[model samples]
Target: MRRDPKSTTVRRTPWPEGAERALGTPLQPSVVYTAADPDALDRIYDDGAPGFTYAREAHPNAEVLAAKIDRLEGAEGGIVLGSGMAAATAVMMGLLKAGDHVIGADQLYGRSLRMLAEDLPRLGIATTLADACDASAIEAAIRSETRLILIEIVSNPTLRVADLERIAALCRERDILLAVDNTFTTPRAIRPFEHGADLVIHSVTKLLAGHSDATLGYVAARDPELRERLRVTAITLGLTASPFDCWLAERGLFTFELRYDRAEENAAALAAHLAGLEGVQVLYPGRSDHPQHDRAAALLGTRFGNMVTFQIEGERDAANALVRAAGQIGFAPTLGDVSTTLSHPATSSHRALTPEARAALGITEGTFRVSVGVEPVETLCAEFEAAIRAAQA
Candidate 1:
């Protein structure tokens, strides 16, 4: 008689066997794994069992990290990669073939836009850039060859919130795959899977890691077939994340809830203060003055995220000076650090776009992107105030 597939009586060996043990999953940094017998190794490889054969294909640490993230995002399975761009590349290469077309958000991370606009075309894949916030625009841009729709949950620098649910519905009607970049909002703020997103990508270097140290990314999908395809592509491209970094990211995941709560509080207080300051135009999803504030509230609920973008009244020099005067803050190109950091879009994140394009997107030289950290609200406000005063002087 055949056993019931759903039976919970399946026998399993105790983990770690004997001798080697750990309260947490121990870091396995070995570049290659081995089995007691050659035939056993061949069986493991042929069966595609859960044992690691090579670091590039899979490993214990990366598996642990991926599992935690998969649970958080409500995905059937997921894979971690060397960087966020690598994850995006794997998704595009795995799911899309030559002659396929992709529809992307007009406002995206600068590098992502570059890939869709320049790189994908070179590979015989066509792409159309549309305003994801406008469902009609996306619908109009779709073609018969369209295979995927790419969007960011909360757009970079500008903080525009996409209508994910509406877009997902549109994608379903067209039988197109919907891929969401959830780096900015994170699973803690909003799980795109809950909104019908087929695939969710996150730059683990950002909020998931909670510190600026780890360089990692992950792609999660509700379909096991999609997840497996992405994993194979990641392995083929040699985009696997370092096991050490994966271990560190897992540690960071433990404190994500606490860190995110504090950071959100800091962002709210700082955004409110900045809005009232002289010569400052603050753009935060939490603020009702923002263009997509209502949408953000509905999708993200109470957590509005830790990013706030504002423009100083003067020129680029004034913005630079203000950043310099903020003695405690670091001017870094990246976000989601433990301490409050500032980034200038014109010279950093959005530098790839032409001047005309940047202008069209409303990202001027005076614009500054703030990655709010877990700092005291009063301290952050005081430092920003002093910096503004110095910039005006």
Candidate 2:
């Protein structure tokens, strides 16, 4: 007798005998999987066996991608999630309790600052904001209840490089945890784990998935025990990433180093040229005039980074004019793309910040942040110069 047509269509097929293996990891989009024995299913549910029962809890794509990120970061263990913010949320939810205290930089990614200042407090967790660039400021803000100190390696917009070595020592002395948001620097620039950070976090949506298609995030924990807690928390909260997005991110990683190197070199050249513009003031760590030049030189690898910020002279209107004229460089609200793009801090990334806070951080209406990308150096230089002239006109 022949099998029913419905069963024939739905049943999984077996591969041919001695078939060649796929050169790359095949995308597994199966949401729910089965096991032969009921006892085996229970073991998988308990994480006693490395098999997937549910996509949200555990999936092959996420596992493989997480492993690669683990190797890159030199982490004890790691997890992948839906978005960068989800990764940050998982860290706080998994590790922090109601009474635990966290010390974070005021200049962290805008959304993270909002979470520290507003969201976490709702959970009865208290967070203190400090100037992470100043190790003294971070020390002064530390309390006996402080459980973690979180800061970006290179701050957004302003690009202040934190003194990780000093802060890591302080965390060690006080037995406090150190978490570095390394989205900007990535592991390519500096892996925070080697500098004594207990947790290395990244917004994989940006550089790791350099083409700007994937919205993924990662958190690498140095302690095995902590890793399990985070993994469980992420799974329970339904923050796990989709198989397709994880697959895209994996593809992006293959050429990440090449894109990063070229983009960084382009940024250095652009910053140098923009520095000489009549009225613009460039904020690049590679430049001697930058406040954190020495620290960036000491701490960062090869070049400064792919970000270059400059204030357009005159007013916001001048900045607007420049954006209008720079037809080649797309005006985007995001960063870390294959082609160069410009983002406005006052209106986009740092919009949540109040006027006073923005001004204090040197983020003005005229501030133009260029997310320098893997474009030809000569084209970037000429186009940006023309945009400046148009803004002045």
Candidate 3:
């Protein structure tokens, strides 16, 4: 893959004036670093600067990746964590105290919803679920004790777009922090910070990593104090990402723009094609029929993301048959892979939600979500056409 010019330039650190210099930041897999003197070590330990302590506290590769993410997101600072959930956990633990309340979107990733609804309450942190797409509903859910408003830029599986700017305004007026999960739209499509968000989080296991090989998460903050709080919490909780995974994910970032462009184009085309099919109900932000189409266009510009969801005209069995008939597409639970894949939220990501809850989110048994890849549009459409036909038969 060709290196992005900006990445190539920023990835390399200047070498000491006279010694041999390397073109790029070499992977430093050392679990610990040694300081030149006790005074230097004391300074390092006290400052908690990058690469000055044990791997779990800080590491070179992770710092490099964090810097890259911070630059990309235009954040004051950032940190990398073991997984997306780890990042979320660190944020909650760092920012909220016992008795604090959090307002979250009802259409969140299943695991996130479960954590908010079940786990946080156990720790004395109250949570209220509301429709994040509705700014009025979100405002109504807020209370005097509310400390945070958590939402996704584009909701999981169902592709609902949140009015982030308006929500951010509300949070600001109420003196509450707004944390946005940018996993679906990513920094390439939309930078939540630009729209007044206080913190932006991403699951690097998805588009930032590009490939499906690494598990990593990142959080970028507009405030340095908040970033430090998150970093300290991650260190205390031992939630730092592995050095090797950070390196791999950084490599993935090199090709992210290219991959996202192709996948987005393919997704738009697929959505249009699926909408024309006789027994399909397509849901994509790019389509005029989507309820949030104008909002998405205004917020994301031309990049409408790579996910396309639809429901077949039948019961759960027919949807299952359709997935089985799509011989050319891989059936995977995750998204943001280079190869096109399909996932059933009812069985995979959102299975923990009750039937009524799922129905409220418009996630029916016939609903199927596709993560479009950088494949030839003609080939992908043809294969899908055949699969749909076979399923109908």
Question: Largest lDDT belongs to which candidate?
Answer: 1
The lDDT of model 3 is: 0.88
Compared with the true structure, what per-residue lDDT tens digits does model 1 show for residues 242-297?
Answer: 99899999999999989889999999999999999888899999999999889999
Candidate 1 to truth, TM: 0.94
Candidate 1 clash figure, as a count = 0
Worst 10 residues of 1 by lDDT: 8-17
RMSD to truth, every model: 7.9, 1.7, 7.6
Task: List the candidates' TM-scores in order.
Answer: 0.94, 0.96, 0.93
lDDT of 3 by residue, 152-194 (tens): 9789989999988789999889999999999999888988888
Per-model C-alpha lDDT, please?
0.90, 0.89, 0.88
Better of 1 and 3 by TM-score: 1
| Cα lDDT tens digits for candidate 2, 45-82 | 66587788889987898888888888888875689999
Which candidate do you rate higher for lDDT, 2 or 3?
Answer: 2
**TM-score, ranked from best to worst:** 2, 1, 3
Select the stronger candidate by TM-score from 2 and 3: 2
Off by over 4 Å in 2: 1-7, 15-17
Per-candidate clash tally = 0, 0, 0
Return the TM-score for candidate 2, rounded to 2 decimals.
0.96
